[model samples]
Every structure is written in C-alpha cells, then in structure tokens.
Target chain A: MWAITRLLAGKDLRVEMRSRVIINQVVPFAALMMVMFAFALDSDTVLARVAPGLVWLAAMFSLLVIVQRSFALEAADGALDALRVAGANAGGIFLGKALALAAQLAVLEVILLGAALVLYNSHIVGSGIALLVGTYFTATAGLAFVGTLYGGLAVGAKGRETLLPLLMLPVVAPVLIGATRATEAALGTNGATATDGWPWVGLLTLFAVVFGVGGTLSFGSLIDE
Target chain B: MNPLINMDTRATSTRFTSALGLATLIGLGWLAVFGLFLSPNDRVQKTGVRILYIHVPSAWLAYLAFVVTGLASAGYLWKRTRSLTLDRIAGASAEVGVLFMGITLVSGSLWGKISWGTYWTWDSRLTTTAFLFVTYIGYLAVRDLGGSHEQRARRSGVLALLALVEVPLVHFSVRWWRPLHQQESVAKGKLSDLMLFTLFVGLVSFTLLYVWLVMHRQRVAALDDMVDDGGLDRALADRRSEGMP
Candidate 1:
C-alpha cells in the first residue's frame, strides 16, 4: 500500500513538473474568467456584489478542466494499465488521483486569488486570505473526490467534454453554494470569524468522508467494468 | 444499420421477464383509468388540484427510477458481471425519471398559475423535482462520455455513486432550509378508502408501464449488441426474404 501510494503520487507530480500540463490549462482559464467577470460588472460597486460567486464559480469551472486532463493523461499510452499492474489497490489509486486533483486545484485557486485581488481590488494577506484559501481547499477537496471518479467514467465516450459539465454541474451544487457563501463572507465588508469558515469546513469534511471512502472501496470495481 | 429487428426469437432473456414486468403493466392501466375518473376535486383549488394525479405519481416514479439506477450501479460495480440487463435497467430508469420529472414540473406549474397567481413558485417540491431532473439528465449524459463499453460502464457507475449523494440532499433540502415548495406529509393527506385504492392502482399501473417499456428497451439493446457482433446483416437478409420492412 505504501509503495503504491508513493508510486502513484510520485508519477503525477513528476509528470506535472515535466509537462506542466495542469498550469498550462489552468492559468489561462482563470485569467480569462476574471477578464469575463470584469466585463460583466457594470460598475466597480457591483463587482463586490458578485465578486465571491464569480471567484469560486470561475475556480470551479477551471478545476473541472484540470480534472479532465489529470485522468486523460493517465489513460494515454497504457499509463493507467501500468498503475493497475503495479499492485495498487483501488484505494491507493483513488487517493493518488484525488491528491493530484487537490494539487491541481490548489494551484488553480492561487491564480484565481491573484486575479480577484487585482480585478476587484479585494484585500488579501490577512484573515480573508486565510479564510478564502482554506475554504477553497475544503470545498474543492469534496468536489475532486467525486470528480476523479466520474472523470474516469468518461474516458472513452464520444463527446466527453460536452458530457462532463452536464453530469457534474448538478452534483456540484453543494460545493457551488457553500464555497460561494463562505468566500463571500470571508471577503465581505463583515470582519472574519471562525463562524464563516468552520461550518463550510464541517459540511465539506462530511462530504469528503462519505465520498472519499466510498470511492476508495469501489474504485477498483468501476474500472473492471 | 437496421434500427428495428424482431427480438422474439432471443432465448437468453425469457426467464427474467416473468418476475416483475408483466404484473405491473396491468396494474398501471387500471389505476390510471380509475384515478382519472373517480377522484373528487380539491375544495379550495377546485379542479386545478386534479393535476396532482399526474404531478404526484410522476414525482414518485421519478425518484423510484433514480433509486433503481443507484442500485443497478452498485450491483455493476460490485459483481462485475457485465450484466447488460443492469445497464439497460439503469438507462430505462433514468429515461423514465426525466420524463416523469418533466410531467411533474409542467403540471405543477399549471397548478401554480391558477393557485398561486404565478406560473412558477420555486416551491419546495417543485424545486427538488427540478433539481432531481437535472441530476438524472447528468446521469444519462455521463453514461455516454467514454467511447468504449467498458469505459461507459465504469464511468457511469462512478457518476451514479457520486450523484446519489444529491438524492438525500434534495429530499431533505426543504427541512434543512426554507423554500418556496410545500411539505408533503402523506399521500395527499390521509386519502379515503377510495382514494387509497386509486393511489395503489396508480402506483401499480405506472410501475407496470415502467416494466413493459424496460423489457422492450432491453430487447432493442440486445439486438443492437448482436448487430455490433455482426448479426445485423444476417438478420436483415433473413427479414428481406420474408418481405418485411
């Protein structure tokens, strides 16, 4: 188990550094999202109203693209078949895939944070920065737990790109609402408090536990089909 | 690619059809007819409340279909039997789920226009049903994502498991938060003996239709598999000799 974990994690990180595939896909999308949101706002004042939602919504959309690439890379050239033959448990595979997703999403959020700060003149580097960054990870951890599973499912289908958002959007509603509300509160005119960040954390923790464990146990069987 | 081929001669599926499919078809017809005729109109809303006949049943069956999809998904992941029957069952349920959910939404909106003076309420039941409908559409969409049969089955099982989380959330969202939809405590509130009988008949009949359609769909899927296996040309040739279309 330990060997498999290391192998899976090492592989993703190695390829990520070599190809920089995640950053290549993610940075441009986050930049474009901020530019689009900037155009949508009629005035600087209205930016505050929609800022939190746009930040996370954009982050979520970018994360979807990263998740797709993460699996797509594995599926090419028998890389996934190699992982399976390496004696990796389904649990290890799930854990590694989710970790790769988490890594990719964390980077995406960083780019988004930079854009939000510049575009909206939102304050950073204090409680708000901590809250926004923390909740972003929690909520997205929950999102990636399931996203990798479905990303795998979509491996060979026609129209996979079109099909993914249709499947993912409704299921991601909780993350959408929770992340939006949490980030909004953190960056709000209101001062930061644990109250703003903790509940979102708690709910997301529950989500991660249920789906994370379920995916671990079931991951092996899914690929066999 | 011949779209329609006769499946009656297929020998592998005969045993499975007898258990649940036939009994339900008879029940659906009886209930739908009786409920349409016998139930009295609501006192406050008058005849507009009659739309509940479609709304409630469609809502019920929609949920039932998703539940079946989840179970089939679980079964596929666990047993790895590659049971085409299970995938076919999951597909039918998702299709029916979307269909019924649509009826519930449309009929509910019509009821709302008269009852609430607005065409839409975002009411609790209506909101949940709409969200649930979207979820199933996602289910169907995800099942088509990967190119190969193996890819479709694996990915769909994963998506099904993930989406099932929303089922509980949608059902309980009303209690968890305030919403525009209403609370449904009973099947239209302590239905009288006749109403109860009608409701039973309705549930049974709808369930029957669900089964019959599923059977026919499976047969079609099986024939498609055969054609993909190089049987289509042969079957079409056989049919041409008999001068069938």
Candidate 2:
C-alpha cells in the first residue's frame, strides 16, 4: 500500500513537474469559464449570488478534465499495465491516485478562486470562499474517487471522447446538487444552505465511500487489461 | 473448444418466434393508436397531462431497468459462471434505461411547457430523473471498456453495484431537493384504481419490450460468438471435419 502510494504520488508529481499539464489546462479552462459567465451575466448583483456555485462548478469541471489527463498520462506510458504485472494492489493504486487527483484539484481550485476574486470583483477568501472550498473538496473527493473507477473502464475504447461525458455527468449529479446548493446557502439564501445541503454532503460522502471501496475492490479485475 | 457446446445438440431458432415479436408490435400499436391518441385529454392537466403517459412509463422503465441490471450484474459476479443470459440482461437493461430516460427527459420537458408555463424547471422529480439518465449513462460507459470478456465482465459487475446508488438518489432527490416537481402522491403510494390499472398495464408492456429485446439481442450475440469460435477452431485444425468435410 505504501509502495503504491509512493508510486502514485511520484508519478503524478513527476508529470506535474515536467508537463505542468494540469496548471496549463485547469487554470485556463476555469478562467475562461469565469469570464464567459461574467460576460453572460454582466451583473454584479447576479454575479455575487451565483459566484459560489459558478466557482465550484467551474472548478469541478476543470478538475474532471484534470483527472482524465492524469489517468491518460499513466495509460500512455503503460504504467498501469506495468503496475498490474508487478502484482501491485489495486486498492492501494486507486487510493494513491485518488489522493493525488484530489490534491491537484485543490491546487487548481485555489487558482480558480484567485482568478475569480480579481475578475468577478468578489472577496477572494471570504466565508463564501470557505463554502466554495469545502464544497470543492468534498465534491471533488467524490469525483476523483469515481473518476478512477471509470478511468479503468474507459481506458480503452473507440470514440472515448464521446463516452466520458455520457458516463460522467449523470453519476455526479448529486455532487452538483450538494455543492451548488451549499454554495447558494453560504451566500445567504434563507433556505438554501448546507444545513439542507448537509444531507447532500452526506450523500456525496456516502457515494464516494461506496464507489471508492467498490472500485478498489474490483480494481484487481482490471489488472490484466 | 471449451467443451460447453460439444453436446451434439444443435441450437434451434424456436425461441426466435415471429409471433412474439408481432404480438409486441400489436400491443405497442394499440397503445399508440388507442391509449395515447384516443385517451381523454385529462381533466386537470389537459393536453399537457397526456405526455404523462409517456413520461411516467419512461420513468418506470428506467427504474425497472436499473433493478434488473443490478440483479443480473450481481448474479454474474457471484457465480462467475459466464452465463450469456445474464450478460444479455445487463446489456438490455442499460440500453432500455437510457432510451426510457431520453423519453422521460423529452416528454417531461414538453409536459413542463404546458404545466409549468416553461420548458424547464429544477423540480425534484426532473432533477432525479436527469440524474437517472447519468447513472445508466455510466453503465453504458462501463459496457464499452475494451478487454477480454471475463475482464470486462468483472469490471462492469463492480460498476453495476456502484451505479445502483443513483436509484435511491434519483427516487428521493425530489423530496431531498425541494424543486418544482410535486412530491410523490400516487407513484410512491397514493394510486387511484384508474391510475394504478393503467400503470400496471404500462409496466407490463414495458417489461415485455425489455424481455423481447434482450432475448433477441442475446441470440444475435450468441450466434456471432459461435461463428467466430467455429471459424477460429476450423482454421487451427490439422484436418478439417465438420463444415469443411
């Protein structure tokens, strides 16, 4: 387990250092999303009300794209094939990867928050930002946790470009609900807070644990592939 | 060559009856022609409610498909028996789930226009059903993972179990997330005899569609597998016997 963790962290760190792919992609994607959103709305009042959810949503999307790239790097290098052949534990591998993915997403979210602060004219690290951070971490944990599972499933396929969204969007709806609502609540809607979203948080957390555990359990089966 | 099909019993096409397929066609035709176009325009919801027949049944099929997929997926993993029947069940269920979900989305939106004075709303039922679309979409995604048969099956089995989370989440997210969609009154419990009877029949018809499609697709797959296996073995033989001889 420790070995897998080291490999996971090492592999992602190496990639991040060499290509800086996630930063190049996530930062730009998130920034563009914010700009487009601001362009569409162009209202300061509306921006304040919608900013938290927008930040979280854009961050979530940026992170999803990041997760795929993370896995795709391993896939292209045949690292996954080598890992399975070496008799590495599937659970450990998934854990290591999920951790790294979460870590990378956190970094991206911070950048996104910074950009939004300057661009959207909102407080950067305020309570709303706190809610955004919490929601991003929780929802992203669920996303990466599930992402690794699907990554293995979609590791090989034609038109995989098409498959990822079809496969991903629906499964992660709960995260969107919880994160968006929690963000909405944090921004001071009378009834839209995580107080209600706490259950959704609970749901997102539950989904993460269940699928993460299940994905790890079944990871061995994909070892040969 | 694994000795499973060497029992000398030739596979037959009896199960592939024209009659059963025709009967389903007739039933669907009756529903579309009579039940849909011929049914009353509804008392409360008016023409808008007519889409309910499509929406409700589509939602029903989506849910049923999830349950069936889960069951068959469980069986495949538990026994590791490699049954074609179970594989077909999973395959059919996912496809039907997606198709019904598509219907549910479209008809729901169309219904929403007349009922809610808009084409879209974030109501709870709509949200869950939309998520329902995602759950099975993931299943369909899992099915496409390329690998050897056993490996694919094992991976998909785990996915099947994981995707079941959407079932409760979809069903409850309505009440869970206070949206425009009404809380369940009849579908969950409060069904009048008229509604229940129509729904029961609708459910039966949907199930029938599922069964027929699954069996047909299974037959096609089994045949394709047989042809490939036979061709490979014949190519390898030191001497050609069966078809060559």
Model 2 misses residue A44 by how many Å? 2.1
* lDDT of residue B94 for candidate 2: 78
- Candidate 2's residue-wise lDDT over B59-129, tens digit each? 88787877888888888888756675676578777787788889889888887778778888776666667
The estimated TM-scores of all candidates read 0.82, 0.82
How would the docking of model 1 be graded? acceptable
Error of 1 at A114 (Å): 3.4
- Which ten contiguous residues of candidate 1 chain A have the minimum total lDDT? A189-198
DockQ of each: 0.40, 0.50
Say which candidate scores most in TM-score. Answer: 2
- The digit string of per-residue lDDT tens for model 1 on B134-203 reads 8788877766544445556666766677778765654453323344455552545744566666766666
State model 2's lDDT: 0.69
User: What is the lDDT, from 0 to 100, of the residue B136 in candidate 2?
Assistant: 74
